[model samples]
Target: MKLRFPTATIAAVTFFASLAAGMTSPVLAEETASPTIVTNLRATPMVPANAPVRFAPPAEVVQTLSVVPAELTAADDSVTDSTTDFSTLDAAVAAQSAAIDDEELNCLAVSIYFESKGEPLAGQLAVADVILNRTTSGRFPSSVCSVVKQPGQFSFVKGGRLPDIDTSRRAWKTAVAVARVATKDLWQSPAKNALYFHARHVSPNWGKARVASVGNHIFYR
Candidate 1:
């Protein structure tokens, strides 16, 4: 079989095929026509995910740590560095005597001097304790002088007055110290809780519970 076409139609088909071959793609033409731009930037290194980070404390925060109040330091020192000693009864008596010049202290010393001067130191202090205990007890006057000078109590009291004493004697000094010791509760006497006492030479038949016996005197509660 033979195929035949007109000469004009053949010419038109040949012109369209030549035009399609001469055209370029739109995206390729744009890329080729644009100018190349170059920048002077450097690449930064990335930190590892497992790395540890450290930040320094601020200067003001470091300075504030050493600033403690002076009162707080002083309170701590007082508790740690105290030097007062109370090792023995005589030591305690010596310590307390420097502060014992009041009227009550004088009355207590005078009573101890006349009543128990011949007795041992412990016995003399016991006498002072009994007087002080009487002052606290509901049965007697509240004041130390009143308790010592009460009617019919001590043999040395004449007309509610204390007798003259030779203050120059060592016995009087010791009596004063013993009185101070008892008043300040610096020493515990063997005649604790005793409200009454008498010479052992005479038996009053007090029928009261006996508390202690020191030197020549016996004490009762």
Candidate 2:
């Protein structure tokens, strides 16, 4: 134990010992090895299959909508106005006839006579007569009010507005009675199938076109 080693030999042994300790240490082993890399596959983005998509509308796309024709609407109006609940035009006229009186009938006859010996009493009645004549000729309304209020038929219609009648007037009462009689077909012999008429003084354009003449008036076919 007392023997001493050479100086060079001691130095070489010390260097080899330090190198072996460094190789066995955990810190040195970690610093000498290659670095590890990690990746997370779930962090990547993806599009859903049910996602909504945008697009421009077609230039010539076809569309559908509901509509009502004018003729169909008019037919509906006709059906509503002409309900078959009333038995006949005559029955309706008779029902309304009771509302008139003898005084009204005389006043109506006087007013009608002022126009002509056998003329209709009121303007409405005159129009009704014209319509009746047209009906018999197969060219006008068959009903009383329908004939009197025919579209564009009478000048007194005033833009197709029917005036509220003054039923309280003596002349109007007479006119109403006359209307009732005419509606009842009491004077059918006077203007049978006559569709045209004019005042006694003025010749009618329809005179030459006449089928007959009654009292001071001429009638047409």
Candidate 3:
């Protein structure tokens, strides 16, 4: 049997079926109606997996970033003091506050006193520079005491021992100041980089390069 409904009834039935589907699933209807939400989600920017992450540092950390370290500033001040100009080497020696308590400094001052105390201030500083240079020359003992007491070196060292020094003499005081200047590198040495020096009276016959002849001694590099 063939059953045929009217055109208006078929239209009414189709409209009700669509309304029922809308009531059953309201989320699907909302998504279909508002497509801009989906567009926004798809349009969002994404970082690559290998991209570097960046963050704003705290205010205190940013403030400290440009500040210089205290130790480094002190080091710079020391360098400036070393290069300060004086009218003469005598002025430089006079400026030193020489306290001869340290054993190494005592050894250096004693050597200067015995070797060239009678010589001019420049001569005394030259002797100190020679001893200081020998400490770093890698060819000699690495300390002032060791270098001074090295066998067959300074004539004043008697069997690896230094002789008693008269500490009350003006010459001894001057030697102590000269040692301070040399150790601190406050003044440039006339006998720069000198490793060995001998009295001007004797020739050791050493085939070494001569650097300078300051007062009573001849300095060799």
TM-score top scorer: 3
Return the TM-score for candidate 2, rounded to 2 decimals.
Answer: 0.39
How many backbone clashes can be found in candidate 1?
0
Tell me the lDDT of model 3 at 219. Answer: 94
Q: How many residue pairs clash in each candidate?
A: 0, 2, 0
- Model 3 TM-score, all chains together: 0.63
Query: Which of the two, 2 or 3, has more lDDT?
Result: 3
What tens-digit string does per-residue lDDT give for candidate 1 at 1-221? Answer: 87899999999999988777666466677777664421222244568999999898899988898788787777563343234446776776665543346889989999999999978888999999999999989999999999989999998999999898888887888889889778767678889999999999999997999999999999999
The residue-level lDDT of candidate 3 at 175 comes to: 95
TM-score of every prediction relative to native: 0.61, 0.39, 0.63
With a 3 Å backbone cut-off (N, CA, C), the pairs that clash in candidate 1 are none
RMSD of 1: 15.2
Candidate 2 CA-lDDT value:
0.51
